[model samples]
Target: MTPPRNVHARAALLMLGSTLGFGLMAIFIRLASKDIPTWEVAFFRNAFGFLSLLPMLALPALRQPRPAAAFAASVRTDQLPRYVIRTAIGIASMFCGFWAIAHLPLAQAISLAYSSPIFVTIAAILMLGERVRARRWTAVALGFVGVLVIVRPWSHAFSLGSLVAVAAAVLSALVAIQIKQLSQTDKADTIVFWTYALWVPMSLLPSLFVWRWPAGIEWLWLAATGLMGTVGQLLWTRALKLGDVSALTPISFMQLPVVTLAGWLLFGESVDGATLLGAGIILGSTFYIAHREAKLAREQRSKAPSEAVEPGS
Candidate 1:
């Protein structure tokens, strides 16, 4: 089904803006890597991002006023443990992704990370019990083939950096799954806030092993990393609010090209044809999966009973 015309337009614009910010974020991560350790880089990024969201949280509109009975009934305090687990998983994903960015060619790293949606589709089938049609399965198979093209396992031995990039994508898929689970009971802001709250400690742990003070110019890079992340998150929040996620998801594929161009022009790295080809395949598969899922969800909603059933019955 087509989304509303306004929603479609908003999704296109918002996702485009968010993706450009994400691409710039990749460039900042590379620049910061020159003098700062990846862990510290992750730490500052999370720290400044956390700091930046404070004002938004203070806004009256974002804070819902609750009656004592309604608050107790709607809020599930028992879900705290689940929130912590999701936060830990997210932090680990962040660490691995940052490490990959520091070590691999930026375009290659971004392309590999783009494989997360393929993993996400698989995870949805296995863990969420979501049904997948044959075409999506074929797309998933083709997507992995594309990954192998980028990795070229048969050519030479695997490069650890490239492998790390693949690992980042896989871990990010897991993180996305965890977030999906958490979203059943938690608001998006709550989940995102807890992620950084948990990140500071987990990210700081790695710094103990390889901490390095930033040089004068390095400070600028680190600050940009943090600031860009906060800006990206804000754009994402607004984007998702303005448009349905399924509509916006496909537009995010633009990040690969944007990041690739930034890598070449700013860092003098080449954007190879093979990486672009693989990214195209992966992104195509992901978009198909998202489109299918949206169709399934709409069908399910249309089938719901006129009167809602009790939670257990």
Candidate 2:
């Protein structure tokens, strides 16, 4: 469904804010992961985030569970099976992504995951039956090439962490496709809430095998990480709801620059020439994809009949 113009403007701003918050959260996660185990960090992040939302969820408007099968409804209820599937995929993606950030350079982790959009485009075509036009296909191809540049697999031995980040991107793409499918049958809040609600237990399983208590300061950082993540997710969902995905997506690329700067200032990491070049390519391709999507949306709207009547026909 087409959103109003005001929604588009708000979504764009919110998406930009979400990316910035996300980039900062990555930095904090990396810092906290230094002294704490990855699983512990992940657990705390989700647990604290869930606790933080208690007040919001308590509100009468958001209290009831969202039901599936009514795409536009403000409230909804169970589609337990779909939530289970999406939450599982999302948990894996988050687990691997957090682990990757803890182990790899922050910029590298962020850059690698940026490939998710390319994966999303492919999934949309293959699984969702979205048409693959020539320009979009070209953009998809270019985006992957940019990822290859960043990975540079042929030049050096690939790290397991790098592979994990790539896997995270693939899983994230699948989850996103699931969201798209669910959007056809469910309200946005229902899908978002269910994914998080179910993920808590699933994420706890692996952490249980290796869980350890964090120190006082570590707990604070972990709590902060969760807060940032929760806020970021809220901003992200709100953004997409306000505008076309294509219009809001390009703003997400801002995350790379934000993370890169954070890594430099906070961690003393340098941005190599290769990384910069690869980032440029990825950004360019993503911009093209966003432009194409917005163009397509506009074209569709233009072809629809106007509500206005002709003068005294």
Candidate 3:
């Protein structure tokens, strides 16, 4: 059955809020990073995000063991090795992401962040041994062109900030691939819990090297980082459950503009033409790639006619 119209509307609204939450979370990360070490900011974000996930554990049915699955449905997962690998890379990505937010122009940083999917496509082909066609190859090429447009490492256009953001994107793409591997065996909640749980300890070790107390309202900024990150994820999860991924994914790009506006109004940062043009090019390419993937998935489903995968599963 088709989702009700109201359901679609609600999904749109939820996705909108989710984007806003994350956009603001980036702002908060920048604010918090002004006074705190990047690693420390990441740790507190993980620490508080994990705290917010506690209420989810209270849902009785979520923890039930799946007989066929290798892992249970609770906070614990049997995928220790996988979790360890993912956590390490994810923390590195978070560190880069937060640092970029603090150092780069918000628009430029956000633009570079969207380059993850381009890297994802490359990683999928190399690591997953997946075959690719000319269309996706072309899209990936175009995506790289867009990245170069933004990075402009040779001239005054992009430098360390762009490089850091790109590193974050690359690491993030690797994490995405790892998550795909884990999702083949573990439940989403178990993966999420383990991610944040493992991140707290993993992220803490490095943070100690640069740790200092949060001065004044810096504590509030840190708190907002955790809270908004968690809220955005929760809202995003719900929105995806209620709407089509193809319909919702584009709404996420709204985050760039929201964050850019915040950067201007709050920090007096001005965005330049290269960033916007580069961002548009990158977005267009990634959007096409996503559209193709979704279409291919739909075609596969039509061919096999299996039971529909449950939301978030």
Candidate 4:
């Protein structure tokens, strides 16, 4: 079925914006890495990102009589344990991801990072006890083939950097599942607040070991990393809400090209045939998996009673 033209256009634009934001984020991370440790970069990113959300949290207060209390109420949550778990997994992913971007070819790191959905499929089956048929299993297998193509451990193409990128994807998949559970009980705002609130300190420990004040433009790059990441994330969430996952998932791959171009232009990085091929394979496999999931979901919704369900829920 065709989505409404205007709706799909809006979603496409949002996804493109998100792609640019994230591409710039990788660029900024590399720039910051020249002078600052990746761990400190993570710490500053969280601290600035957490601060960036204050105005957003305050928006809710404007609607209520007691602004201060309303703001406090918005931030209050009973889900500290869940937030801690989620933040731990997320911080680990963040660390691994930063390390990869700082250490690996930008295209390779970003391409492997995109394999999170593959891991999510397996994680869902294992952790959530969700049933999957042979088809998704095949798609998942194909996704691994893409990973191997990129890594190619038998050849010089392989390195710990490649493996670290894949590990980041794996932890990211777990974070996705954890967020799914938390979303059931926590408002999106509450979850966002605590994740960053806790991430600030969680990422701080390792950072202190290497802490040196960011000098001159190192400060600018560090701050831009936080802004770009946060804005990209918000746009990504918005785009998914507006468009079909099957469609938006492919659009998100535009990030790879954006980063690939930036990597070559800014850092003089070279991309090889394997990285391009592996990235394409991963993109194809993921798009197919998303298409299949959407089709089955539609079929299931049709079979159930005639109650209103969210279009993309």
Candidate 5:
């Protein structure tokens, strides 16, 4: 077995890889947006992303002998409703996110999107009836403060694109909650496969209304966006599989700097002080929440055997 430290190192590296892939995906999305409608970009992103998975789906058959079983295992007919809802919400999230990225500075858009964890906490309380202790509540409060700082309402800095980005974050949080629920009954691969399968059609519906042919280089950018997204998801899943989520969670913040640099170099975008401050506050709160959850999980595991033992052994 791998040592715990090595496992953590590997997970961290995988997370870095995931962040880089996602950052590049954002860059490509921005690039494609220059020549195509946001809806068209969304459609091609999902379509090509689904196509990218075809080789991986077939690889199991090439290595082993059971092609039919490999293909069948990827689909879960019983979970159609859940998959549909997830994809529907995901399509909305992508449309809003693509539009936001296309209009706003890349780093600003990314920081705003990272606010999903804050919304996820709120969703758990309202939807799942999950109890929030005082510290978590405080963290949630500070997270919102961070968001306000970034948005800076009543200021010239805020725009419709900023609100759209926040909406995307909320939608993304809803999808995250749905994925958590689905995880109780579905294998990770099955969930991923269904996302692409359902998303391809749902995302296409919006594109149909605003269709435009990609002009030469736009096609390449669109393909890169799709490929990057798929690779990023795979790397993120592998990182979680390899190590503790709490330990790996912070590594994702690496994307902020990566995207910031990409935006500066590629698009002449600069990060302002307020945006940096807000991102720091938001990330700090989320990190605290993650740490607390990990600590509580550890405490529960430590007590499990004692609680399970008979009163008088």
Candidate 6:
């Protein structure tokens, strides 16, 4: 058996690999956007992602005693409503995110999207009725301040792309909350498989209005984006299975720097001083929030065994 320490190290590395895959996906999105419309790009992304996941779905079927039943079980019909809602939200988020990536600097678009964790925290309070203590509230406040710093609303620095990116973050938070609820009754694979299955058709509708077949290397980038996205999702899930979420959460921030470096090297995009400062502040708040949540989870787990014992015993 693998040592606990080794498991953690492997998880951390998987998380890093996941981040790298995401960074590459962003780059490919940018590259493909040059020739393809954002709507079409979104469609291809979901379509190709769904196609790439077929092998995963098929592999399970081959190993099961009842292949047909196993295949059907992978997509639970009872959960279709929730999956539809989740996929709709995810499609909207993807459309907005792709548009922002097409219009804004890679770093700026990614930085704005990073605000999803803050939105998720707020959503948990309002939608899920989860209580937030003062420290987390403080972190939320700092996160908003960081957003203002990056956006500079009163100045000319603000643009529609920034607003769209923030909208995407909000939608993404909603998706995250939905996933939290779904995880209670469904497996992760079911959730992912259904989302991609549903998303392909939903994304295709809007894409028809803007449809233009990709030519030349455009096909390569679009396919790469989908493949990278699917691979990244797999890595992220594996990482969570192997390590504590808190240990992996901080590692995700590594994507911003990786993207920033890619932006500089590939596109000659330079991040402004204020943008960098704001990103740092936002990341710091997110890190704190994740750390606090992890600490609380650890405490709860530690107490569970003791609480289970009889008082007399």
lDDT of 4 by residue, 1-313 (tens): 6678999999999998998888898889988998789899999989887777777777879889999898788878888888898999899999999999999999999999989988988888788777777788888889999999999999976797789999999999999999988888878778888898899999999899999998899989988998888888888888988888888888888889888888999899999999899998898888888897777677777866766443221
Residue 260, candidate 1: C-alpha displacement in angstroms: 1.0
**Model 6 RMSD, rounded to 1 decimal:** 3.5
How does each model score on TM-score? 0.88, 0.86, 0.91, 0.94, 0.93, 0.94
Name every residue pair that clashes in candidate 6.
none
lDDT of 2: 0.79
**Candidate 2 Cα deviation (angstroms), residue 194:** 0.9
Error of 2 at 280 (Å): 1.5
Clashes of 3: 0
Q: How far is candidate 3 from the true structure (C-alpha RMSD, Å)?
A: 4.3
- The TM-score leader among the candidates is 6
Please provide, for model 2 over 7-52, each residue's C-alpha lDDT reduced to its tens digit, 9 standing for 90 to 100. Answer: 7788888998899879878987998898787877888788888877
Of the two candidates 5 and 6, the one with more favorable TM-score, higher being better, is: 6
Candidate with the larger TM-score of 2 and 3:
3
Model 3 misses residue 304 by how many Å? Answer: 1.0
Tens digits of per-residue lDDT for model 1, 1-313: 7568888687678778888878778889999988788889998888777777655654533445654444344433457777677667777778789988887788888888988888887787777776666788887898897788788787773576788788878878888888888887777766666776677787788787898888888888877887778777778888877776677887787888787778778788886677778878877777777776666665556767674322100
- Give the runs in model 5 whose Cα sits over 4 Å from its true position: 1-3, 61-64, 304-313
Sequence-dependent TM-score of model 6: 0.94
Candidate 4: regions farther than 4 A off: 1-3, 305-313
Residue 179, candidate 4: alpha-carbon lDDT = 91
Candidate 2: count of backbone clashes, pairs at least 3 residues apart or interchain: 5
Per-residue lDDT of candidate 5, residues 63-125 (tens digit): 657777757865555888879989899999999999989999988899988888889888877
Tell me the lDDT of model 1 at 111: 85
